[model samples]
Each structure stands twice: as structure tokens, then as C-alpha cells.
Target: MVRILQGLAHKYFSDEEAIILLLLLVVGTGFIIFFGAMLAPAIASVIIAFILQGLVAKLRSLGVPEIVAILGVFLVFMGILVGFIFGLLPLIWTQVSALASEAPRIIRELQSYLELLPDQYPHLVSAEAVNTVYQQVSAEVGQITQWLVSFSLSSIPDLVALLIYVVLVPILVFFFLKDRRVLISSIGRLLPPQRPMMARIWHEVNLQCANYVRGKAVEILIVGSVTYVAFKLLGMPYAALLAMLVGLSVVIPYIGAAVVTIPVAVIGLFAFGWGTHFIWVMVAYGIIQALDGNVLVPILFSEVNNLHPVAIIVAVLFFGGIWGMWGVFFAIPLATMLKAVFAAWPVKTLERSPASEEE
Candidate 1:
């Protein structure tokens, strides 16, 4: 066991740089795990600044002054932020409240539909099974209601934190953008000058993560806006709310679309019943999803390395378990970072003895 352990350690961590990198990763992950909540605003600012850095670089490439480019990108970000806060947020909130008010009616309709299932499919579904299912759903809904009430009652502190983020994030993002080089240089100064392995991993991780984060942001906006327009055209209820769900559903890769389909289908059924209109609404949604998967994704993420569906799902589950929504959101990026690290990691190959080589 001792020899085996030593062999494994020598094989994987023989390089001093590898040991240093491992320690850095451990320390960084520990910091985030311990202080993530308190430093959320700063973390958010970093992500936003990272996303906006591409635009800043593009403008700089076109001979725009760095300060001007930063200001331009910053202003555009603020406009979008303000629009979302004032316009889109209220619309979504109103729809959410409206949906909540109509929930009992929807539930009743659902219960009535389920009650007929046993009769329609007597062999497949029993009355007892239907009753059990309804009970489970009702219990879940009740729990959700309780949770919402508690959350609302406790939301004052959250709102205060949100206000602080709104004020501080922009300021932090501006400085981050303005002092991007200075910050990088300062941090770089702390590390050993000879860090080829670290440099390679950072380069790959930075490129992949930046592309993913920015592309994902664009995808969500496009998918949500297109979904909203399509739902509105189909005269679907809760267009904004449904669109938001549809947009966010993309975050979970293969599972998000499948999960969100239930709500969209349910809402469409309630609004249009089992008819051509409902069919059309579903068809439109299917088309949007198809286009997003086949067209938009390829275009936006042309430079990204595509993970297998299973790997993506596993990453989502693992990271989301660790950091909740943030983990879910950055699962792909984090996974990519891990992939790059593994690819670049230094490993000393075991040397064969003369007897083994002769054999």
C-alpha cells in the first residue's frame, strides 16, 4: 500500500510546478467555498467584467482608446441592466403574480383531467394511482407555497443585498475593466516567473471559459426574446414568464428544455385546450429549440470545445450541488477548466527496469 501510494504520487505529482498548481487550485476553491456568499457581488462583477472584456478588446483592435472602449461597453451594460430592471422585470413579475392567482383554477382543471385518466386508460392507470399522484402534486404545491411565503417575509435582507450589488457591481466592474492589465500584472507578480504549466492551463481555461460565458449570455437573450415573440404571436398566456423559463432552461443543457416543456405544454393546454392552436404553439416552441440547438449554438460557440451530453449533465449536477444556481450557470465553464487542467497537467511516466524491458 505504501509503495503503491508513493508510485501514484510520483507518477502524478513529481513536478514541483504541478504541486504548486495543485495547492493554488485547492486554496482558490477553498476560498470560494468558504466566502462565496459574502463575496458574491465581487464575484459577479468579475464575471461581468470578463464577459465585457471581449468587447473592450474588439474596440481597442479598431483603434478605440482603452478608456473610451471601457466607457462605451460600460454604458451599454448599464442600459441593458436598467431596461431589464425597469421594463422586463415588472412584466415578468406581473405575469408571475397572475399565474399564482390562477394556480388553484389550473390545479382544479388538472385534477379533473387526471381524474378521467383512469377511466380513459383503465388498464394502464388505476383510480388509486391517480389519487396518489394528485395527492403528491398537491403536497408539493403546498410546500412550494409555504416556501414562497417564508421567502417573501424574509426577502428584505435579500432586497438590501440586491441594492448593494446594483450600486457596487457597476463600480467594481468599471474599475476591473479600467485596471484589467494592472490587476493581472499585480496578481501575476505574486506567482513564480517560471510557470509554463500554469500559463498553459490558464490560457486554455481563460479562452474556453470566456467564450462559453459570453456565448451563453447571448444565447439566453436570443432564445428568450425569440421565445417571447413566438409565444406572443401564438397568443400564449404568460409569454414573458414562459420565455424566461425557456431561456433559463438552456443552462442545464439536455435537461432544461425537457423540463421546461412541461410548463409550456401545460400552459398552452390550459389556454388553448386540445386543439390546433395548442399544436401550433408547441410546434413553434419545437422549432425555436431546434434552431437554437442546430443553428445558434454552432454559430455562437464555434470556437468552444463541445463536451458530451453525459459529461455536461454530470457537470451540471456536480457543480450545481456545490454552488447552487451559480454552479449550474458556470458548470460548463468549470468543466472546461477542469478538462484543460487535466490536459495540461504534468505527469512523470514510470521508467521501465532493464529486466522488464528485456522481458
Candidate 2:
């Protein structure tokens, strides 16, 4: 056993392990820097806007004229953006306003509930303490609203930057699509002769990313459609807006679905009143999750890059902490890339062979 342990350690440390470790370290460092660079909202927006360009490129390859595809996709995306702003925004605003109007009533109900709690446990009762808590909570809420307004005002520069991205993304995406073949050939030529393996790995990674992108699009559509119908049936105000939010939230791993449900259900309960309708909405969401997990996910999301659910969740949390919404948006793609890289490594491949794979 001692000799076997020594042999194993020596094999890992002295053989290709050292090189692989170094490559992984370098890749991690580069990713950290790349994320930091994407902190610029313009950069982030441009990157997202390129998704449309990607769709255009796909259409062009399918026999549509390049210019026509680009124009069509661009216009469709812009129209949707405009529709959301003009149509959905007002409904969302009105519903939100209604919720705000009900805040005092909810507060009073909550205080009554608290009073009941203290009355049940006389030892915990303190009239002054309860008043202080109520006052402090009210004051904190006012400050939060003020902060939100200030923050909104401060985002003017970011909005302007996003406009620049809207103009630039298409230009960049067009060039990227036009030169994609050239880029791949150039990259292939640059691969070191000793590493003929890298070309195959690159091809595999490309295939994996393509599958993931297509699957994700389907997932988003299914989620959005289901959410919209559910919200509408519930008689919830701003159903479209909530549906859009729920659909988009699915992009984030783990808690996204539940996170979206909170606001929708809370508003439904308060604005529309908590009763059969609210419960049915909850039931609908639960049914949706059951369908997603059993039916939808299996059918649409079957092309996973072999990443564990935990790894994807961790990536979402890590990136979301650093870059907030944008990080969460790109988490799956980045995680897929990491999985591809790991899969391409010789040690990982060998470790998953036959007996080792079973272990």
C-alpha cells in the first residue's frame, strides 16, 4: 500500500498533472479578469445583444440572405423591447402602485398578528417595544423608497451606455459572423503540433455550446408561455409582466422560479385578496415545476454538458454575487464552458474510463 501510494503521488506530481494544474490555474485567472472587464454595463449589454446576432447568423446559414436575416432579427428584438416598454410597463406600474397603497393595511394586519403572538405569551409582551419596532420599520421603508429613487436617477449614465451597446452589438456581431469561418481556421492553424488533440476538443466544445444555446431558447419559451397562461388565469394584475419575469428568472439556477413566484403570489394575494384564486395560482406554479422537472426539462434540456446541478448552482451564486443580474444571466454558459474544458483534459477522461467511471 505504501509503495502504491508513493507511485500514485509521483505519477500525479511528476507526470502531466503539473501541466494540467498550471493550465487550469491560468484559465481561472483569465476568467476572473474577463468577468472584471465585463463590469462595464456597455460591455455586458453588447454581449447580450449579440444573442440576436447569433440567431441571425443561424438564419443566414439556413439560406436566408445575410442582410435580410440581420435586419429581421434586429427589428423583431427591438419591437419586443418597445412592446414591453409601452404595453407591459404601465400595467406593472399600476399593479405596483396598488400594492404600495395596500402597504399600510398589511402593516396593520401584521401588527395585529404580532399583538396576538404577544398576547398568547404574556411574558414576551412589551407595548413600547412593539411601537418602537413599528416606527423603525416604517422609517426604514421610507428610506428604502428614497434610495430606490436615487438609484434610478443615478442609472442615467448606464442607460446611455446601453444605447451605445445597442448600436455597437450588431456591428460587432455582423463582423464576427462574417469572419467566424476565418476565425476558426486561424485558431486551428495556431494549435501547437504536439497538441493535435486540441482541435477535436474545440470542435466538441462548439457542438456542446450550440446544443446548450438551442435548448436554453426552448426552455425560455416554454417557461414564458406557461407562466403567462398561469398568471392570466389567476386573474393576477400585470400577468404578462410577471410571466416575463418568471421566464427570465429560469435562466438563473435553483432559486429563480421560487424568487419570481414570491412577488407574483404576494401581489395576487394582496391586490386580488388571498383565497381560492391565490391558492390556485400557487397550485399552478407547483404543477409547472412538476412538469418542468419531469417533462419539459427532460425533453428540452436533455443536452446538458454533464455538469452537476450543484456545480451550476454554485457558479450562479458565485457570479451573481460579483456581477449581480448579468453574472446570473451568463452563469450557465460559463459553467458549460468549464465543463467542456474539464472534459477535454486527458486525466479527467481516463479517470472516467470503464472501472474508473464506475467508481
Report the number of the highest-TM-score candidate: 1
For residues 19-78, write the lDDT of model 2, one tens digit per residue.
644575588667756765554543443444445556876897899997688668766766
Model 1 lDDT, residue 77, Cα: 97
lDDT of each: 0.92, 0.67
Q: Mind giving the per-residue lDDT tens digits that candidate 1 earns over 1-359?
A: 99999999999999888998899999999999999999999999999999999999999999999999999999999999999999999899889777777777888899999999998999999999999998888787777666665776788898898899999999999999999999999999988999888898889888888898889899999999999999999899999999999999887788999999999999999999999999999999999999999999999999988898989999999999999988998888889888878878888999989999999
Model 1 C-alpha lDDT versus the unseen true structure: 0.92
Clashes of each: 0, 0
Model 1 spans > 4 angstroms off: 145-152
- How accurate locally is residue 12 in candidate 2, as Cα lDDT from 0 to 100? 45
